[model samples]
Target chain A: MRRAVGALLRKDLTAELRTFESIPAMTLFAVTTFVLFHFGLDRSSLEGDLAAGVLWVTLLFAAVLGQNRLFVAEEEQGGFDGFLLAPVDRTALFVAKALALFAFLVVVEIVAVPAFGLLLLGPDLLDPLPGLVLVLLLADAGIAIVGTLVAGLAIRTRARDLIAPLLTLPLLVPVVLAASEATAPLLAQAGAEGPPGRWLAILAIYDLTIGLVAYGVFDFLLED
Target chain B: MQAPAILVRDLHKSYPSIEAVRGIDFEVARGEVFGLLGPNGAGKTTTVEILEGYRERTAGIVSVLGHDPGQRPRTLRERVGIVLQGGGVYRHVTVRELLDHWAHLYPAPRDVDEVIELAGLGGKQHERTRSLSGGQRRRLDFALALVGDPELIFLDEPTTGFDPAARRAAWQTVRTLAELGKTVLLTTHYLDEAQALCDRVAIMKDGRILTIGAPAELGVGALYRVVWRDAETGEVQSRETEDPTGLLHQLTSAALARGEPLRDITVARPSLEDVYLDLTEEPSAAASQEVRDG
Candidate 1:
């Protein structure tokens, strides 16, 4: 099972590197959306709640774009059948895909976060870097869990493009809500403070709950 | 003795609007090459999918390598390889890379390079799958199926789009696997392919096996078509007869006495192609007497 997951993950990352299919598009979407927000808000720099809200929303939609392309290789090229034929545990696919999505989100954030600071932040980014990183990791995990499951469900549908974002955005509301709230204090112009622990707890709990649910139901979804 | 490679009995699969596979039963013995010959919409693929654990049976018994395929146990999957009819491979990787990745999925896989050679893909190992021609892609499909070193293999229309040369090469690969004592069950529309490769074949139509037997056995009592040009009338005539030898003897003796040869004297047996068309053309009326063989 471990070997299968490793192979699948390696294949996905290699394909993504070659095609620039998901990560570049995701990062570009994040930065482009930030530019749109800059023009729309007419603000040189923003602090606290507005900064946190704008940052999380942009990242959330960027994650959606990444997740949409997650299973495309398999779904398009009979990769699903190849994976299904293997004797490994079926959940290995789900694990590998979710990990791939998480990795993509982290990569996008690597550029997008600093860009967010440079473009529209009133507070210095250095103060809250470590704490913000923790929040982003937890939020990305929740999104990956829910995103991988929704991507699998939507890929087989006819209006997969419409279905993916529509399904993903609604399920992802809680992640966005928790992430923005946690990051608000860190982005404050008054002083950079660590996120309240409750929101981090909520993010962790959401990841665990959906991660289990997605893992359990993924086998049934692969059948037809 | 070991169990047969596959055992299916009274298998049935139905969708919401139609029944795809009406109650069918057949068994493929160990190391035997079995072919399922059928027309479009004949449920050949559905039945094969059920046996491969891709789809659940509507009702019936199916055992592949002694494990219920519906359960899809890893033990069974480890021993059974499949070449799907129309699935695509990852487009970015070279043929060798894709085969190497698939080889790891099984506990005991064949050497990647040998499988590449067996599928006639040695020259194209470094080419990305996206750039492969259609025939090369199909050969890669064959390579992936064989890389697992399976005990039994299911090939669904293994050579649909191959050129004559590629088809012959694919047949040679199947022959090699058979020589190595692998049980193979393949489905194809090509009657000649079935005739050449299958030890036993089951012809199907509208979701039922109309006839099942060795290729020779299916033509046991079928008529041969004989054509000749009548000397006096200077016109062509043809007859379907059970004994072409006797009919030709009578026709030739009379022609010799008349001092003119029977021109275009040609005798052709009802090949498996003929028998397949005869059975599949009519619906269930002629198929009521289903032929079964051990």
Candidate 2:
């Protein structure tokens, strides 16, 4: 299982590097979302405590672009049949794919955050960015787990584009709420401190619970 | 006591309106190419998927490699390799990456390079799978299916779109697997492929096996067709008879007696396709059709 997970993770990461498939679109989405947030809410009267909520919401949606393409990485040429033929545990297949998407979302957010900081929010608006990064990572992992499964199902359907996001977003709301709560303090202040760790714990539990659910249910979805 | 590699008893599956496989029964030995020959929409794919542990059966018991496929699929699948109808190589990843990825999934896998060589993808190992031709990608699919060195392999229409040269190469690949003594369950619409590769074949229609046998032994004993030129009419005539040798002797002796040669003589026997059609042709006598006239 370890070997299978490593190989699959490497395969997907390498494929993402080869294509640069999701990052550009995700980056553009994050940047424009940031700019729109700043323009609409930067004023003294309109600047609100919902900056973190908006940011998490933006990042969560951007992940849909990344996650929906997960199975496509293995689907384009002839990979689906190969995957079915492999001897690995099916649950490992689900986990490794989710991890790969989580990693990609992290990479895009790493760049997008700084770019968003410079271009939209004043450069110093989000201080101690590491905590927010943690929130984003956790939330993104949740999104990827559910999104990856839905993407797997949707890719097999005739109406994939319409169905993937529909299947993904409903599961995404909990992650978005938890992550926004975790980041709200910092997003609303020059530098604020609260028990963001509690929110992180909630995010972790959701990830563990939802990850297992998706893993256990993958076989049902994978079958004809 | 040894057991069959695959045992499917009274299996059944249905879509919204049709039962694709209705109470089918069969067993495959450990080292034979078992052919499931049927026309399009005859439920071959559904039955193969059920046997591979990739689809749920509506009824019946199915055991592949000693585990019930529908109940404990992973236990069965780890030892089974499958090339589903069109599920082949992934396009975005390089060939090396895809093979290496699938290779790692097996409990114990063959060398990745050896697999690439086996699949004939040595030169294109670094190319993106999408960049390879249809045939190359198919070779990659075969490589992945072969990676785990599975005890049983399920190939569903493995060479559907291949050109002649590619098809022959794939046949060679199948021959290699048989040489390795691997049990392969093959489903195909192409009778020639069934004739060339399978040791035994089961002809099916409307979700039932019509007959099963060694290809050559399938039909009623071969009938010989005799053709000859008729003297005054100048038109050739043909006839089928069970005793061609005796008929030929009698005809020639009569011709000799009449002082005329038996010209344009021809003799032929039934081939597998003839037997296949005979075995698989539906007897509408058993079928009740809903007829409408305008």
Best by lDDT: 1
For candidate 1, the docking band is medium
Worst lDDT run of 10 residues, candidate 2 chain B, spans B285-294
Which residue runs does candidate 1 get wrong by more than 4 Å? B15-19, B86-88, B222-227, B238-249, B266-268, B283-294
lDDT of 2 by residue, A72-118 (tens): 74565445655665555666778788888888888888888776566
Compare the candidates by TM-score and give the number of the best one: 1
Superposition error at A26 for model 2 (Å): 0.6
| Clash totals in order | 0, 8
**CA error at residue B292 for candidate 1, angstroms:** 31
Q: What is the C-alpha RMSD of each candidate to the true structure, in Å?
A: 4.3, 4.3
The DockQ score of candidate 1 comes to 0.65
Shift in Å, residue B267, candidate 2: 3.1
- In the range B1-294, model 2's lDDT, one tens digit per residue, is 679999989999988988899889999999989999988877898999887666889999888888887764555667888865446555667788777777777777778898888878899999887787878767877887888878888889999999988888888888888988889999998899999999999988889988888887775576777889876576898888999999889888988898987789888676678777776776464353433221
Query: In model 1, which residue pairs have backbone atoms overlapping below 3 Å?
Result: none
Q: How good is model 1 by TM-score?
A: 0.91
**Least well predicted 10-residue stretch by lDDT in candidate 1 chain B:** B285-294
* TM-score between candidate 2 and the true structure: 0.84
